[model samples]
Target: MRRLLPVAFIVFGVISGVQCGFGLNVTVSSFTKSITSSIGNGINLVVKANASIKIAADDDNSGTIRALIAVSNNVTTPLNRLLGSILAAATAENVNSDELFVNIFSLVAETRPALDAASNAASDLQKTTKEYLYQTLSGNLTELSTILTNLTDGLDYLHLQVYQAANEEYPVTSKNITIFINSTVIADITMPLEAIQNYLTHVASVITVIASERTQVIKYLTQMNETISNGLRNIQNSASGFNRTVIDAYHRIMAQQVNTFKNINQTYAAIVSRASSYNGGDISNLTMFLSDLVAANASFLQFVSLSTNYTMEQINPVLQDRIAAATKTLTRVARFIANQSAINISQHANQCAQRFMQKLQQNPVVITRLSRCIQQDSNALQPTVTFVQYQMDLVRSAASSIANQMSKVCQRNTGACARAYFAALPDHSQVIQNKISVIAGVVSNDEHVVTGRIINCLYGTGADIIENALLMTKKFNRCMLVGP
Candidate 1:
């Protein structure tokens, strides 16, 4: 039971951090310092208890308990020093969230050895015959459990502190909000589309070169190459056109909507500022303010509706078409491989198989170009995946902060009205994430099929030929047919 405490606290902290969108705050320094102290004290108690158990187990000639304590000591020294470093690093309130989680995670991982040793020691004492050994081990474990429970209490306090810290009201200004919507929201969304368009153009060029190679021995090789080449071009063109016609247009529409939203927010702020300066006897002024609030809310709702409808009607169908183009390409390549007659073209087929094997071994110009092209494609996409994920972290933080500010205004309204207004706001993070994932998935699936069916099949034919040339064609067909 005591051994499970660390894991539970670690999980609690992680879930709390995630729910807050992992934002940095100006009051987390004290909370980090407090938790670090608790973990340090817990580590010391564990080390002491472990040393006492080792001495007693050695006296009783219990090899199992002695070995456990030795293992525990090996990790204890490093854990102690790392905790000191964490204490030193928490000099400011706005400590990096990633660094704090990493340090906390390190403490949990290193402390696992002591927890496991205690658990095994308790179990071994259950079967011991000597009364002295049982008494010694049992007493120390009780003390250790007490210490762990104290640490658990500290962890609970720290978790609550973190939650409250993350929710502290921030002063939202027009400048900062405009910076967020324009840079973090709009730039993050469109940059990937641009990168992907460039990627498609380059891939099309490489595929065209590979498809133009004339086969000397294999008659069907030319046809299969043409099928793959044409399919890739279709995919490239589909995505390229979609980006120009749909995604670019959507980006412009979103930019216009954000500008409108910014204008409306400024109008609301002006109204509030003016109302605050008025005297209490101005009933007509108060009524005018209420009318302005209603108008602002209506305009905000209209903006949300326009953005949502534009995304659904303009963007979604083009995304589907891009995915469909990729799927169709993969199917055509697979069908071409499946339709080959292995029996009818025996003489030329054998020569063709031998040539394929030779090409893989000698690393000819075609094979070299193909390998480099595949590598280039992977390199292009790897960064997009990482960039999108990093941008999403910022997007989530912005969304949470914006929602917090909006909720304050909503509280002035009736419950049903507040719910309706809050529910209509766009989830920019989720929508963008879903769109990028779909595009990446299409490319990833196409890459898998090409590598497995075409590149790997050729390489396998080489290996099979070395073992038995007669079985090469059969194995090659089998490899191509199992395309993923």
Candidate 2:
């Protein structure tokens, strides 16, 4: 407390102003009053400086005590704000992560229904193709049987003509005539059979080849679709659980930080309160305490600034990028699956029908007369079975091309999709490592700033101010500092 100044000023001024005598008589009352006022002014200035330090040790009306009274404030705002900001940032980040997970999960769910539909379409296409094979062969067989009768009648007439013409030239033998007639009938009858065989061969070629290819494609599709759907579903479940754990940890980290700030503030405030009551009417300790308080405020501000930098520059930006990448990659994978599931081989059915119809229209083997076929056996009316073999080859080649092409495309697309999905899931390790490096640096820098700069500044400022009151003259001290 600064009680020494006013009393010393009044006593010294009166003692110096009165003439030295056996009987005490005070002569310069005005001079004593002027000296006391002058002394008071100087001490008042020092007291005010002490008061500003936030810890006032003395209680008095004069200069030093007044300064002591003013030092009684506390450190508060910056600490609270620093902790609050951290909690807010953590809360926001947690919410965003949760939202991203939900979106990806929903997209994965959408693919299953589409996959089932695609499988159904494959089954329909197979049925239609099988029915076409059955109907075409059954109707064409009767037409071939009628052609056989027409050929037989023509052969008999030819034999009769030959016999009639030869009667005038030579003796006709019944056995030679019978042999010739039988041979002609056999030739005529076998022609239509060859045509029927050609038709059956081509029909059989389409049925066997096309059916086998279709079965393989559909089986591959079903397996691929099921694998993707199940894998995504598993990933979605696991990722969501992990995210919840991270979010909860983040919340706890933020809460602990806030509590740590509160504890620090309370400790310092209590210490400063104790510091103010220590020395007898001396404000130097209080002044020093106030300096440290101001410095602590600076330290807290630095901590908040650095912590914020860590989040904004390192943690938050990385989190946002991860969220976007996760969302984008997951959505892309889901879309591929859904689109594949919706892939209808039904669309290609029309193309197959159109090609089959056009081939029948242009076909000399199926729609034309037996005369249209080039004969392999000259003596017989039977057309070469070679046309039937070629037509069978053509139908087989066309169906195989379409089925194989579809299967190849589906395999290529789904294989790529599977690779990409796996790539995205395993990507988190690298991203997390990057974020850890950034946050680690920020934490180190913030700790240094808070513990080193602000704390050191406060201690250094107050440590050098010991006996600062003695720097003034005796008269100055009488006004500024109270004597023990």
Candidate 3:
């Protein structure tokens, strides 16, 4: 049961990442396992990332309103947590994917005890986990950094090799391999980074809240030279494992993405090998071209070279771009979840705090005793005060991180969306350009041979050939202006 959740989570994450492919390749479904991993991983990330959103059930739900209004209602009784209402609203509303994230957050809130086992476990390790995660997430992910670097290097090497081979194999270099290839892979990675960043920001906020609560409890007890009440400690202790579970969820999701990256790395290596080593080992898409090249047919090398160029320069970039775009959408949806979560938790916490304050107000004797203890042992109280201050600082830091990350996501996603196209222009656009250029050259070269004075004596057959070439050029020119 423990492992099953992570597997499911990875499936969601990978599936979300994979859908951002260029639509031209009908063969993209070949990566069928990716969908499984995407959903499996992403589900956990969404749940863990969604913790704060469900701080309390929305009272607007009839079930919850009825529950709250009941005289015998107890803390143990389940509240609506807005799960059904949020989902129904999501479906009926014209909101984008962002609202879907809020629905997930609401559901997580509804299932708090189930989702926040880390907190319920009452382990101090949750704090440790939060510290480490904050450090790791705030910095670079080494594996991802390495993968992107290698991908860039591999693409560069491919470009160098392609340039050297372009003249000999195809007798012309038409496409700008560097501009189209390298640029798009960057887009592929951008969306995942954005998505993960959103999840992590909320995660940091949850931890800060946990830490702050514990510190407040400690401060309250230190004034009396005593420990906090069992009830108070238990409330704080319930949060001990929450941050760790959130971190674990992120890792589970990212692990699947790392696998996806590895697959792309392998594909990149295989394609580059075709140029770098110039071997005919097992290029899946170019069986016919490989066969022709192996048979020592130089003329077929043009077809082989063009096929390789099409695969490398056009298709792969679009595939990566699509994945990136899909991830961006997934991450953008995370915002609504975070916003709803913040509202619920703040309101719920305030109510709980007010109840605590009213109970203390009714206990003048206990308040007087606590005040005397603090006045008599001001020095003894200094340490707890400092700790509370430190925790408040952590909350501030986390809030800052959330703001910064959200700002960056907005800037990058909005900018990328503004320039959106489902497929790369250079994918088939360059092909159109190449075909037109080839036809124009052919027509220009054969102008004298076809439409010269000799064509008038030859029953105008050469003239007809020239006219057809002009028509073909016009059609191809139109194609170049738009796309294939």
**TM of each candidate vs. truth:** 0.22, 0.23, 0.19
Error of 2 at 29 (Å): 99
* Candidate 2 residue lDDT tens string, 1-484: 3221221211112224422111112222232233222222222222222223332223111122232222111001111122122222212321333343234234323423322332232233333233453344333333433443453354345334433534435543443433333444434433433443343344334333333333333443344345435543543443344334333433443443344334434533533465433223233433443344344434534544455344234422333343334334333332332222222234433333233223222222111111111111111111112222333234234323322343345444235532342233223323322332333344445433433332343233222221221121222223223321
Q: What is the lDDT of candidate 1?
A: 0.37
**lDDT agreement of model 3 with the native:** 0.30
Model 3, span 96-209: residue lDDT tens: 333444454454344434323322232322232234433332232232223334333433443343334333443322233233323344334333334333443443444445
Clashing pairs in 2: 1-281, 1-282, 4-482, 5-478, 43-479, 43-480, 53-290, 54-71, 55-71
Whole-model Cα lDDT per candidate? 0.37, 0.32, 0.30
Top candidate on lDDT is 1
Off by over 4 Å in 3: 1-175, 178-183, 224-484
TM-score of 1: 0.22
Q: Model 1, range 342-451, lDDT digits (tens) per residue?
A: 22223343444444344323322121222232332333333433443454344334433433554566554335544443344444334433443443344344334433
Reference-based lDDT, residue 328, model 2 = 41
Considering every candidate listed, which one attains the maximal TM-score? 2
Arrange candidates, best lDDT first: 1, 2, 3
